[model samples]
Target: MQKKREPVADSLAPQYPIESVDNALKLLLLLGEQPQIRLSEATRYLGVASSTAHRLLAMLAYRGFVRQDPVSKAYLPGPSLTGVAFAIFGRIDIARSAAPVMRSLSEQLRETVHVGMLDGASVRFVAAVEGPAAVRVASRLGRAMPAHCTSTGKVMLAQLPQPELRALLPREQLKRITSHSIGSRTELETELAGIRERGYATNREESEEGVASVAVPIPTRAPGLRLALNAAAPQNRLAASRYPAVAAALVAAAKEIGDQLG
Candidate 1:
């Protein structure tokens, strides 16, 4: 007989000082929901005194569960949360959800397909499927490419608010990954504006020589789920004449993945 699954205990379970632990978890959840939250707001939300909230925040920060911005006095989630997130993601296997879509797109478009997510100032490829064509573009899993020079990165950037986007990449010392890479902030801003308008982005030999790609953002029901789906190929095969059709297919695949996620 098959075994039944057991209910998992909540992290805020009353093993420790229940009030303190609950307050800390509430603070973490609030910070996770917003891009940045002020200390006063946190204290108000927790129904705690300013000093008490500060002490709790200080303890959390000391343990690396959260971080405070000195200038804005705003709190944000720290490395510990990212560590937990990565651990959970490692087990969940987004590749399993994305693989068939990637394979189907690759087969239809005769180009490589990649599923990636924003990581700091870069896009990290989590999954890739190579086309059967002789002149295909191949990307390694876990490869990190600059956000300003890749289709997947631009799609993610387009979704960010101006302040968060500026905070993430203030200066544009964009690397020349290829001759076509955006070399300055102004150029990248232009490209990002276009991406926002079109709901998609493209890279014509911007991340690597002889490679071109188009991407669409994969929307999730909850916040902080950063992901995009892209189709890439050799520049010669993905010329302007062929870009529209490839882009349409990529958009369709992204929509399918988004629907599944929802």
Candidate 2:
């Protein structure tokens, strides 16, 4: 008779304060599930007193794990979470890993291709491939665009945890980069939601008039390294009528890059 297969067991389990950690995780999960959660709601969900929830959130905020809105008085994830994420990404050869794929995509689509990473309030292009087209979107390798405007920036923002997104962008001071730019936190949030559902993001004269772009997130094999691949062209050539094709190509490029990275 064949030997029975043994059940797989979890290794590297923690020894102490598993319950406390579990509670913290539960709180994080709860916050992540909602767009924003009030102190009372968190208290009720965690079965802790309002005072206790406040205290916990305070500690979390101090440690860079969570944040609270000043006006609405809600809680969300903090920059420290992204800090930890970047630490993981630092181990990989990000540029070397993304270059060939970007070049291939640019060649295939005949449009400028860019790879960007979220840096605080902006997305910085880390790699780019120039297309053969005579007229193309001109972008330098180190160009930074506001996260609230560009297609790559929007895609990166969409992948972030809700609280983290809120923490990065408060309700006030969402600027209008162009006439078409999103002017408020609410509108940006709605756009991000749609991007998440559609698996792509678009910028139609949002960052600059007569410039249109399409982008898709390049999921990293490691945590905290939010990256996106984008294709941009002059509005006359890459009009709204061409968005579907451009969006599909961008998504394919992102997936190809992601598979190689993974």
Candidate 3:
């Protein structure tokens, strides 16, 4: 006679997950069910020491799963998790779809590459790839910047309708980020017009003192979802003379990504 299945094995749980990982997942689930949690609460809930909970939260923070409030020291869910929901809902999956393209573009140009998403008046870097060069521009992941002063942002803004663009941007006092930043909405409109005509945009010490970038729009199947790909390097390395080649590389990568998304 064959032995009956063991009662404890009825659930078919995986056998290989580390105990700490299991606890971390449990903690993640707990965080999901609530608005926020403190470190002591995490420690108690995980039955680990304060240091262990801190380390786990640190790892999650690095991976963009959760962020801690500076004032309250409470942890909350992060933006990276939105990709999972977007994927589940059959959305464009921007970061996942653009990651390999960004990597390839960065490798080709030996410059930092970013996939930026525009929301309201801000540009958020959804994905970043670092070049092999030791002195390349730094990654801008998980940070939001004013849209009008960035190459990727211009690529996005140039596609917006005139009414929408006017509604989003202020008429004056456009926060000069640097000496190269567009000083007024009128100037920005002119700059955006050039970007639209050329099918790409360039940033020369606009967002930062020494940074320069070239960017192109990445067409997507999803409606009203504007995305851009950019290659950034130090101003001295990525000069006006190099913009065409860099823009070509970004455009090629954008086409590959758009084809995949389409």
Top candidate on lDDT is 3
Off by over 4 Å in 3: 1-93
> Which candidate number has the best TM-score?
1
Ranking by TM-score: 1, 2, 3
Alpha-carbon deviation at 193 in model 3, angstroms: 0.8
Count of residue pairs whose backbone atoms collide, per candidate: 0, 0, 0
TM-scores, one per candidate: 0.72, 0.71, 0.65
In candidate 2, where is summed lDDT lowest over 10 consecutive residues?
1-10
Pairs clashing in candidate 2?
none
Q: What is the lDDT of residue 202 in candidate 3?
A: 94
| Model 3 clashing residue pairs (backbone) | none
Error of 3 at 259 (Å): 2.0
- lDDT score, residue 240, model 2? 71
Name the 10 consecutive residues with the lowest summed lDDT in model 1: 1-10
lDDT of 2 by residue, 106-214 (tens): 8888889898998987999888888889988886588887988999999999987666787788676598889999889889889999999988899989998898899
Per-residue lDDT, model 3, residue 55, is 90
**Any idea what lDDT model 2 has?**
0.78
lDDT of 1 by residue, 200-251 (tens): 8888878888888888887653435578988888877777777677778888
